[model samples]
Target: MIPVQEREQTDDRRSAWAVFLVFLRLGLTSFGGPVAHLGYFREAFVTRRRWLSERAYSDIVALCQFLPGPASSQVGMVIGLSRAGYRGALAAWLGFTMPSAIVLVVLAMGLSGAGNQVPAGLLHGLKVAAVAVVAQAVWGMARSLCPDAPRLTLMALAATAVMLAPSPWCQVAVMVAAGLAGARWFRPAQAQAHEPLPIPVGHGAAIGFLLAFFVLLVGLPIAHRLFPGQWLAMADAFYRAGALVFGGGHVVLPLLQAAVVPTGWVDNDIFLAGYGAAQAVPGPLFTFAAFLGGAMRAEPSGWVGGMLCLVAIFAPSFLLVFGALPFWERLRRNAGAQAALAGVNAAVVGLLVAALYQPVWTSAIHAPADVALALLALVALAAWRVPPWLVVLACALAGWGLAPS
Candidate 1:
């Protein structure tokens, strides 16, 4: 007969494997930038899988929004952690990140020789599909998150502020201001029953992780300056970008461009080409790091550099999410914290709204035909309730057909 403890261990392994497989699918299919990624996560975890409750999922989103690095990716890591401890967290990150990283790296290598050859029509189609996906996300999240007048007002103001200023700092400032407003005026009627997040790390471990995060943030630059190696320099640059940026992948572009372009690590044309190609693929836009790494005109380029940059850029996310969860869980239970989260959640939705309009809309919707295409995609997603992956495929074909022969 098998031992009970052995059986439990086996089950835990299976759970981690399951988390990996699910996230791998998401990595292959999740499209439409960070806001749309959140919508995809909500559908997969909260609505479809029932792995997390609605409020629990929102709480996670709210927390990730406050941290640096990619919010959607961090949410995936926390979900994995909740399911199967540290192993699950690693599994989630690897599965959800690798597909696009691999694709972008390969594309980067090919483009170096083949020149910028990806069809512009296909890329534009993907952007239009993204419009529908983001609209669906905003529509659904608004219904759930902004049910009250005060919260709705907060959402409008936040969206307006972000749209006007439209910087990473503005997004962070809006969230902070919204949090203060929530604390002062938006207290819940009565304390509702709480759904405790299953954070496996102890308080001591959490503190250690936070310390490590800061240590690397500060020490990496000094180490690079002191040693002057290619790998260390790349790590320091990518790590700082991930650690400091507030808004998600889009906002990180200028920092990345500055780091690589002026130094001639990557030619300016290749850099812009990779950014365009990044939108054509699924998964986090941060995977553009893989392209930059693979295309670097220096030693340690190709697959080795690609993987290294990918890990370095995303490392802070893992540290921050793990470190913050223990403290976040405790603080969220407080009555005051709940009120503040209410405002923050609304602000997050607003940020999504601004993003949907500026880059997602302005970039994609040019002509009446483009607007028609986006509307059809939206109908497929929100009304017919088709899976996003299928909609993306359909739109790509339509975009190709519409392109001049």
Candidate 2:
């Protein structure tokens, strides 16, 4: 007779492989941003497979939403963790992220050879498309995040601060201020009860992971300065961007733009084009980092750089999810924490609004034709129910055709 331990091991192997295959398919097919991705996840994991109850999945989603990094990816990781263990989490993330990361990296490498030969109008079309995408994102986020007057006020003020200062440090200061203000002013009446998902990792491991997250966040920049390598610098920059993102994937755009564009790792036009390309792909928007890393003018540019960046950008999500899951039950019940998250969410909306204006709009819309195309794209996304990939393809064709001879 087979030993119980051997049977359990075989079962786990099957579970992990199943998780990978399921997520891999989702990664290939899922699109239309984070919210849609969440819906897809719910359909697959809850409604279809019944691996998790709706309540349990909601709890996982709530916890991930509370923490920073890509919410959908975190949700997938947590689902994998809940289903199997750490290996399952790793499998889910790899399966979901690899499809887009590979596509963006390949696109970036190809673009690197073409260089400035890329038509200005075509690039502008991308920028215009980006403007439409981000605007839709900002509108949706504003409605959900800043529904009330107070949160709306916070978002506006935060956007104003970023617009005036317009630096990475300035952005950090704004978020910190938002969190503090949120905690102080936005305390809720009561904490809500949550049915937390079971996590196998012990509390001590969770604490260690949390500590390591911050350690890397603080230490990477210093290490880059001290060590002085392109790879180190790239890792530091992408890691910091990943750590600080509070809202969603769209917010990562400004943070990443600040990190790489200023350092000349990627130029302004290339960065926006990659952003446009990212919207065209399936899977999490975080995969754009792979494109940036691959397209860098510095050493380690290519697939290696892409992999390095993909790992660095996503490392924090793993850390935060693992760390927070242990404490999520208690954390979810804290009214003050929820209030603070609300404020931060509102502030994030403002930050996105600011980004939509300066880099996305200013860089992309240089003509009346550009404005019209962007408006059309926005309508297709927000009103017409057109698929994002189709919309992106349309924008590219429109831009290419409309380019001045």
> What's the TM for model 2?
0.95
Model 2 has a clash total of: 0
Which runs in model 2 stand beyond 4 Å of their true positions? Answer: 1-14
Give per-residue CA lDDT, model 1, range 132-184, as digits (tens).
76677678778977899999999999989988886655766887898899988
Instruction: Show pairs that collide, candidate 2.
Output: none
Over the full model, what C-alpha lDDT does candidate 1 score relative to the true structure? 0.81
What overall lDDT, based on C-alpha atoms, would model 2 receive against the true structure? 0.90
**Tens-digit lDDT track for model 2 on 1-405?**
888755644654437898999999999999999999999999998886777898889988988889889999999999999887998999999999999999999999988879878777677777788998999999999999998899999999999999998888888888888988899888777766777566788999999999999999999989988899998999998898889888778999988998888888899999998899899999999999999989999888889999999999999999999998888888888988988888899999999999998789989988888889999999999999898888887898899899879
In model 2, state the lDDT of residue 261.
89
**lDDT for residue 27 in candidate 1, whole number 0-100:** 95
Q: Would you list the C-alpha lDDT of every candidate in the order shown?
A: 0.81, 0.90
TM-score versus the correct structure, for each prediction: 0.70, 0.95
lDDT minimum window of 10 residues, candidate 2: 5-14
**Steric collisions counted per model:** 0, 0
